[model samples]
Target: MKATLIQQIEDICNTRGVRLTPQRKRVYELICNSPKASSAYELLDSLRETEPSAKPPTIYRALDFLMEQGFIHRVESTNSYVSCNSCHDKKHFSHLLICDQCGSVIELQDSDLIALLAEHAKQHNFAIHNHVIESHGTCPSCKK
Candidate 1:
C-alpha cells in the first residue's frame, strides 16, 4: 500500500506538472508509511536518519508543498499530518475522525453534510472557503 501510494503521488505530481523533489517525496513517504498522524518533528527526525543536514525549515517546506498539492492533510487539532487517501479523486470537503485512544485518524467525505454546511453558511451570507472538522473519540479497536 505504501508503494502504491507513493506511485499514485508521483503520478499526480507528473500530471499536475508539479515538481516532486527528493525531500518532498521522502516527507510524503514518511507520512504515508505511518500508521497514524505524524508531527513535523517526527518527520524531521526520520529525514535526519538519512539526510543529517535536514532542518525544521526543510521539513516544513516539504510539508507545505505536500499540503498544497493535496497529498497530505494537517490535523490542526493535533498539529500533525496524515496522508490523504482520496488525493487521486476530486477535491471535496472532508472531516477527520480522530481516535483519542489510539491516535488513529479516519477521513470522511459527505456531500450531504457539505451541502448542509454550505446552506447554513449561505443563510448568514458567508462564503465558504476552507474548513477543518476533527472529532476525537475511542476507535473501535481501542474500545475493546
Candidate 2:
C-alpha cells in the first residue's frame, strides 16, 4: 500500500468527480496489497473479516469502479484481478505474464504491438473493446 498510489487514485477520483467510497477503497487496497491476483470470492472473504456486512454486490461494485478507472486489470484466464501500477499514468493496451505456479502477474505494454493489432482489427472489421493478453509461465521465483 504505497501512499503515492493511494494519493494518485484519490486524485483521479477527485478529478473525475467519482466518489471513492470506503467499500471500494478497502477492496482495491486488498487487491493492490495482494502478492498475487485474487478472485472475487477471495476478496469478499477477506473484506468480510473486517466488514462483516460486505456482500457480493459490494465487491462487484468496487471491481467495476476499479476497472472503469483503469486502476486494476481483470485476468480473464483465471478469473482473477490484478492491480495495475501504471494505470494511473495513462490508458493503454497491455499483455500480462502470469506465473502458472505462483499465480503472480506482470503487466507488459507495447505501443507498437497495440498499434499493429489495432490495424489488423481494422482490416478484419473487428471493433476491439476489452483486450487482455494472458501468457502463462513460471516466474523468476517459481523457476527455482
- TM-score (all chains, Cα) for each model: 0.95, 0.93
- Indicate the TM-score of model 2: 0.93
lDDT of 1 by residue, 21-138 (tens): 9999999989988889999999999999999999999999999998888888899999999988788863557899999977899999888999999999999999988999899998
lDDT, candidate 2, at 74? 93
lDDT of 1 at 32: 84
Residue 71 displacement (Å), model 2: 0.8
RMSD vs true structure, all candidates: 1.1, 1.4
Candidate 2: residue pairs that collide: none
The candidate 1 region of ten consecutive residues with least summed lDDT is 84-93
- Candidate 1 error regions (>4 Å): none
The number of clashing residue pairs in model 1 is 0
Model 2 spans > 4 angstroms off: none
